[model samples]
Target: MGEHRDDLPLVLLIHGFPEYWWAWRNQIQTIADAGYEVAAIDQRGIAGSDKTPNSSDALTLAQDISAIARSLGASRIVVVGHGRGGQLAWAAPALAPGMVEGVLTFSAPHARAIQRPGTHLTLRTWRHVLTTFVPPLARRGLTDPVSLEHLLAEWSAPGNDGASSQAQIYAAAMRLPEAAGISLDQLRWSYTAVQRPTGRRYFELTKNAIEVPVWSVRGQLDPLLPERAWRQDHTFTTGNFRQITVANSGHFIPEEVPEESSQIILEFLHHVAHQA
Candidate 1:
């Protein structure tokens, strides 16, 4: 969304489940105006992006982020994401260290942290994860405007004025052919892949601590991933790692608090630049 400059670092903004590039509508220009170039993409099967079913595993998804940065002529990149997208950002540095210089994630924990024994995922989160196992039902719920609206409202902080508008946009995008199904498939892989050989390989590859700087932000009121889920994330990074909890915010950190989120992101970007 901003001009690509040789001197300016490229920031790739990735949206999470039930969201696309529009999720970053508020922050795109803000980051660009701060002297950075940004690209907010519709990951894999969401929105207008190609629907590649059965190929949305962690490895493939992280590769997609690296591929996009290279295509954008970025020598080094900062990847920012929310929700599931944030999880991917956590893995990108390990999977593509040459391309990724830093990561800033909103409401996402490290992949290993989520998979550890006794991980603290809320009941609502488990319900959402289980729903993906039922393809037909999950697809329908994701595409239905009423259902989508309810889910967004349930996850967002109280008094969030943008929830309804965000739900409408995401619901419309899900109605695209195969979008809902593919989105569910991505979620399904996140859980079920651990049982497969490929998933084992992925974990092994990312087992070592990430070498790039990482900044993770989450809402104190986030129901899906509570404080316990993210507390150990600092252990996953060998480089600079910082975690911030925003009071009065929920799962939808970026949309719920765009101004504060942008400031946090810009702060991380400046930190990365200084370290480099």
Candidate 2:
């Protein structure tokens, strides 16, 4: 909330599903102006990024995140994500523990927690069930502006109309050729991917691999990923993680509350800097 007294570390933002770099357009400059080097990229398979539709699982996405950090030539980095990207933000620390200085997530639970056994607290209105199970139908019908609008509206706490700058960007991105496949891969693999031997081990091993401090930001208005998930924050990782719930916002907290989101991030970054 206050002006950053010292420059923070490099912070790379990864956007949620059905969106691109433009989704973070509102928060980018604001966070950058607070004295940290910042960059938000289109995750692979959407918008301007490459499309490895079949291979776009969370672990691979986390790899892309680490590679992006190295490409940017930053030594100490902080990873932030929203929605599906939030899952990757959780994995980034495990993938690049030494390189990542901090981890921050919005609108998503930690990957391992959601994938762990005996955990069945899904949000009230997760459209992912339909999207992942009925990919063909979802792809055929969801790209239409009306359907996209409905999807975003249901997910938002305040009910977005798919017209805000952020929602508009998502509406356009979800219509891309690779978008449907990417969306399906995201949630489908979220749990299924962990079923494989390698994935099962990755999920278990990384629970404690994330030693860097983390900040899990949630939208109080989120319909699909609501306050219930916050109860499991302690299970996200064995790292130092805290939760901050934003009001008057839904799944698209960054879009709806850019100023507040930026301040929360700056405060967290500053706190991490002082601790180091």
Candidate 3:
């Protein structure tokens, strides 16, 4: 809870879907060692954090991050979001502009609403819809450590190309019995809330470009967020931004290449500090 360095700023990390604060364990240590306070939180319904019934929408999730930042006595924070967390990170700064100093995301697109029709419609989103519609089954599968482990493993190794050892480690984390603590309704809420209001309310206020510095990191081999999304989002930012692609890494950039990710983050912070 203590800020790492008196002179350095704080880093607020938001973990991706199905992952807890542990996702940033290595990054936190590395960043903290460099004299920055790191506050990595378990997003809603993922861990011990608030499991609000029916609360998986991106807007609500963004609010959760804001609340966490305020609770830590930070008026503004450098937000680092991974995967789904990145999406929320994109939206949060818009809703609470004064509370965010900068935005750094890995594998997350901008806050634009996902078009329901056409090729852009992905199987992954359908899976989320199914889970949202049927809480009991989705909750059952998500809470089952074994099932969750398998899901994370599959996510890590798309088409059997990823490292088996890494996949096993991710799977093991999901399989922990503690995964069953969150209720089915809570898990379902986490997904459904985002699709509500046609996914427009949150982005409407964010339509104007964000003025904060932004960094979007991508893995060269990541299957979750293809290069196409990155290209489309490249032109959407409002302020100064940078996009870096991590070689040979996948969606799990922090887990796959902690040093490279840390280096990129460190350099960005240093640049931001000098500009300030």
Candidate 4:
């Protein structure tokens, strides 16, 4: 709605942890050009946003999206989330079905898929669990720019380390004491939520299949999230789910392939809008 006052639909973009609203910088204007109200907000505890331990929980994060949509005067919202943001995207529709129109996740899969036994928990997952249990080392690592650079290098497709280019910016943003603490909180909470015997937060999310159209996009070389786990998933309430893979891409699809990612998102939103 920056320049166009027409009743264009609303699309909320949520970035993953250790990143900020600027992470979606590539898609904001492009999506707006597609005739939709676009908002790229820094999720809680990330850069330029309020710090809160609640961002660690998926359901609560989803609630943030619903509340934002209401404020925008939209009855239903289209969501696009990446990495940890993608996890919240899935939970959003499940938590507030009547508020979400269609959902799109980038470089992330459903939390339910990852929690199942058949799912393969990669080294990256174990590393997150370890860091959560040990805080002193975590604080040091979180503060180090090299650590951030390393994550960007290791997570993306080979020969495409998106982290190196933005390491300076990210390091500066995460340097804030509150940002570091909130990140640590996410790791700790994620470990507890997954290891608990009866307090599984994702189970509550799965009780009802997401009652909206769902789309997933993954980086072909993202080691943290293997493709096998998503092969037979039918968790969408509408059962109208589709997955897209970008060639030679890693975990940070938007950063790595903005044009392709933006185009895909614009197309998906257009489809949803047409059906409405």
Instruction: Find the candidate with the highest TM-score and give its number.
Output: 1
TM-score of each: 0.95, 0.88, 0.80, 0.90
Residue 184 CA displacement from its true place in model 2, Å: 1.4
- Candidate 4 lDDT score relative to the true structure: 0.75
Residue-by-residue lDDT tens digits, candidate 4, 1-276: 346535556899998866777778888998877667788977777676787646666556667888878877877688999987887887887667677888899977777666667646577867766876787777666667898777777777777756456876887888875887777776566556667533275666556776567889988877777777566456545657888988888888998888899999988887777767
Full candidate order by lDDT, most accurate first: 1, 4, 2, 3
Q: Model 3: per-residue lDDT, tens digit, 93-176?
A: 777877777888987777463332344434664575576566556655555556665665555525432233343444444445
Alpha-carbon local distance difference test for all models: 0.86, 0.73, 0.68, 0.75
Off by over 4 Å in 1: 1-5
Shift of residue 70 alpha carbon in model 2, Å: 0.6
How do the residues 174-235 of candidate 1 rate in per-residue lDDT, one tens digit apiece? 99988888888788888876897777888888888988899999999898999999878988
Model 2: how far is 33 from its true place, Å? 1.1
The sequence of per-residue lDDT tens digits that candidate 2 reaches over residues 8-41 is 5688988886677876777787776776778899
Q: How many residue pairs clash (N, CA or C atoms closer than 3 angstroms) in each of the candidate models, in the order given? A: 0, 1, 6, 2
Which residue ranges in model 2 land beyond 4 Å of their true spot?
A: 1-7, 117-127, 159-168, 236-239
> Which 10-residue window of candidate 4 scores lowest in summed lDDT?
190-199
Better of 1 and 2 by lDDT: 1
What is the lDDT for 234 in model 4? 60
Pairs in clash, predicted candidate 2: 157-221
* True-vs-predicted CA distance for residue 198, candidate 4, Å: 10
